[model samples]
Target: MPKKVTITDIANLVGVSKATISYYLNGNTHKMSLETREKIRQTIEATGYQPNKIARSLVTKDTKTIGVVIADITNPFISSVIKGITDTCTSKGYTVTFTNSDNQEEIEQENIARLKQQNVSGIIIDTVDANSPNISQLAFDKTVMVDRQAKKLRLDTVVSNNRESTVNFLREMKKAGYQEIYFVSFPIEGISTREMRYQGFMEEVTEDSSHLLILEEPGVEKRIYDLIQKAKDKIAFFTMNGPTLLAFMKIVNKTSFRYPEDFGLGSYEDLAWMDVLNPNVSCIRQDSYQIGVLAARHLLAKLKKEKSSSSPKLLVVPSESVIRNSF
Candidate 1:
C-alpha cells in the first residue's frame, strides 16, 4: 500500500530546507525569492499536494474559513443566496460554516458570537435585526452583509435596490390604472429589508398613508377579509416577500376575488411558484444568487486585505419588474 505524501517529502524532493516550504505554505512566499516561490508552486501542483488547512491555521492563528448566517433558511429566496455563497467560497478554497437564525434577532446575535468563537476568517450575514450594535461593530472588520442591510453601517453590504426599484415599479402599476394600491407586509419592527421595501412603496404613494397594511399572523384571515371589503375596483396590492405573498394568496383564495380586472398583485420575490399561478404573478425578479456571490467576494476581499474602504459602502444590485397578467 502506498503512503500519503507529506510536506517533508516535498522539501526533500525539491532539495530545500523544510522551513522554506513551511514559509511558503504559511503565505510567506515574499520571504523567499520569486524563483523559489514559483518552483515550490510548480512542484506542489505536480505532486497534487494539498495543504493541511487545520495545521496551517494553528500556525497562522487564523482559519481560512468563512461563517455565514441567514435569517430564514426555509425561505426559497434565501436558500439560493446561500448556494451562491458556498459555490464561490469553495472555488476560492475557503471553508464555509453557516447558521440559520429563523427570523429571531437574539438567535442572530448568538450565531454571530458562535462564528467569532470558531475563529473564522470572515462573516456574511442576512440578518433578522440589522439595528443591533453588535452588527455594526462586526461591520468595521471581518463581516459583510447580504440581502437585508443595516440602516446605519460601517461595513460592506450587497443588496437588491429595494427602495428605488419598488418605487419605480409601483409607479408603473399606478400608470397602468391601479386606483387603490396597498403595501402589504408582514411587520415593520425595524427590520431593514421590510423597512426599505416599505419605504419604496411610500415614495411612489404620495396620497393617503392609510394604504399601508400590516399582515398579523393571528386573525390574518379575518384581517384579509376586512381588507378585501375595503378594496375598490382596480385595487392593486404589493407584498414585501415571497412568504408574505403566499399568505396573501391564501386569503385571496378564501373568496371569489379575481386579479387585474378586480385586483392587481405584485410581490418582491419572484419565486418559482409564481410562474404556476393562473394569471402569471407580476413581481420583482432579484438576482438573489448574484447578491450572495457579490457579498462573499467582498468578504474575501477584506480577509485577503485587498480592500481599501474604511467607511461602509452599500453595493446595490439591480432588479427587474417581471410584468405579467397579474398586474
Candidate 2:
C-alpha cells in the first residue's frame, strides 16, 4: 500500500517547512507569497494530499466545520436551505455537516450530540423547538437558528413574516368573494415555522364556524375527500408545507374538485412538481436559500470572534405572494 502522506511529506517534497504548509492549509497566510501558495496548491492536487482539518484545528482551535441541522431534507424548502448553507460555507473555507431531524426531538438531540463530539466550530440549526432546553445545551462557540427563533437563549435567529404573509393571502381570498377558508398542516409540536404560520392564519380568520377548518395528520385520500365534501360552494384552502400540498393535490385530482370554482388552494413551500400541475397553485414564497446563506454567514461571523451587540437578534426576511388560478 502507498504510504499515507502528512504535512511533513508535502513540506519535504515542496522544499518548505512544515509550519509554512500548515499556515497555507489553515488559511492563515501572513507573509507567504502568492507564488508559494500556488506551488503548494499544485503539489497538493498532484499528490492527492488532503489536509486533516481536525488535526489542524487542534493547533488553530478552529474546525472550519459548521453543523447544519434541518427538520426534513426531503422537503423542497429544506433542500433549498441546505443548498444555501453548503454554498455559503464552502465559499468561506468551511464545510457543512448535515443531519435531518425528521421532526423528532430525540433524533435532533442525538445528532447535536454527534456534532458536539465532532467539535464542530458552530451550528446553523432549523430546530423543532424555539424554547427547548436542548438548544441552550448545545453550548457551541456559535449557534444560529434558521427559520426559528430562540428568544430565551442568546442565539442568532432568522425567520420570515409568517403571520403577515398568511394574513395577506387570506385577505386576498376574502376580497375575491371567498366566504370559507380552510388551513391544513402537518402535526405541529414545537416547530416554530408551522406554529407561526398557524398564528398568521388565525389572525385573519374569525371564530365563525364556517370561516375556518384546520386539519392535522390527515391521510391523503381523507384530506381530499374532506375538502371535496366540505368545500360547499367557494373553497379556499391554505396548506402549510409541500407534503401537505402534494397529498391534497392527489385528492384534488381524484375527486374532480375544479380549481377556483369548487376549491381554491394556496400552498407554502412550493414543491418541485407544483408548477407542472394542471392549475399551478398560488403560493407564499420564502427565500429559503437566502435564509440558509444568511444563517451560515451569521455563524461564521460569530466564529470570527466579531463583537455584536445584544440586540433582539431575530432576522425576519420578507416574503412575497405568488398568485395563480387557485387563488
Candidate 3:
C-alpha cells in the first residue's frame, strides 16, 4: 500500500513548521505571506493530505460538526428540510451528524443526549414535543429548534408562518363561498404547529369545538359524514398537515362525497402528490427547506458568538398559498 501523507509531510515538503500547516488548514492565514500560502496549498494538493478531524478537534475543542435530530425522516417535507440543512452546512465547511426520532419523545431526548455526548459543536432539532420538561432544561446557547416552539421560548426557533398562512387560506375558502368550514387534525395535544394553525382557523370560523374534527377520535368518519349531510350551506374542510390531510382524504374517499361538489377541501401542506390528485388540492405551502437552512444558520451564528441577542429569537419563514380547484 502507498504511504499515507500527513500534515508533517506537507510541512517538510514546503520547508514550514507543523504549526504553519495547521494554521493554513484551519483557515487562520492572516499572518502567513501570500507566497507561503500558495506553496502550502500546492503541496497539500500534490500530496492529497487530509487533516485528522479527531486530532484537530481534540486540540481546538471544535468538531466543526453539527448534529441534527429529525422528528420523522420518512416525511417528504422533512426530507426537503434535511436537504437544505446539509447543503447549507456543506457550503460553510461544516458536516452534519443526524438521528431520526420517529416522532417519539423519549427517542428525541435520547438523540439530543447522544449528540451532546459526541461533543458536536451545535445541534438542530425538529422536536417531537417542544414543550417537554426535558427540552425546557436544555442549554439554548448552542441549540436551535426547527418546526416547533417551546412554550417558554428559551431557544432559538425557526418555523413557518403557521398562524398567518392558515388564516389567509381560510379567508380564501370563505371568499369561495364555503359557509361552514371544519378544521381537521390528529390532535392539538400542545403541539405548537397544530395549535397555531387551529388558532388561525378559529379566527374566521365559529369557535365551537364541534367544528373541530379529531382524526384519532372514535366515529370521526361518521361525524364528518353527518356534518356534510346536515350542513345548511356549502361546507369545506381544512386539514392541519400532510399526514392529517391524507387521513382525512382516506376517510372522505370511502364515502360517496367528492370535492368541490359534495364538499370543498383545502389543506396546510402543499405536497407534490397533492398536485397530481384529481382537481389538485389548494393549500398553504410552507418553505420547509428554508426553515432548515435558517435553523442551521442560526445555530452557526450562536456557535460563532455573532448573535447578540441573549433572549430567545423566533424566526418565522413566510409560507405561500397555492390556490387550486379543490376549494
The most accurate candidate by lDDT is 3
Predicted structure 1, TM vs. truth:
0.92
Q: Model 2, 89-109: lDDT tens per residue?
A: 999888889999998889999
lDDT of 1: 0.84
Q: What tens-digit string does per-residue lDDT give for candidate 3 at 1-327?
A: 999998889989999999999999877899999999999989988888889999999977899999999899887788878988999899987899999999998898888889989999988888888888767656788888989898789788998999899999999999999999999998897899999999898887878998999999999999999998888999999999888889998998888889989899999998999999998999999998898889888888888888867799899999999999998
Candidate no. 3 TM-score: 0.94
Clashing pairs in 2: none
**Candidate 3: segments with Cα more than 4 A from true spot:** none
Q: Rate the local accuracy (lDDT) of all candidates.
A: 0.84, 0.78, 0.90
Residue range with the least summed lDDT across 10 consecutive positions in model 3: 131-140
Which digits, one per residue and each the tens of the lDDT, describe model 1 over residues 128-237? 76676767547466888887777676567898998888988898899888877888888786777788888888778754657777778566667656666777557788
- Candidate 2 regions with alpha-carbon error over 4 angstroms: 1-52, 151-154, 207-210, 217-233, 252-254, 307-312
In candidate 3, which residue pairs get closer than 3 Å at backbone N, Cα or C atoms, i.e. clash?
A: none
TM-score computed on alpha carbons, candidate 2: 0.80
Worst 10 residues of 2 by lDDT: 209-218
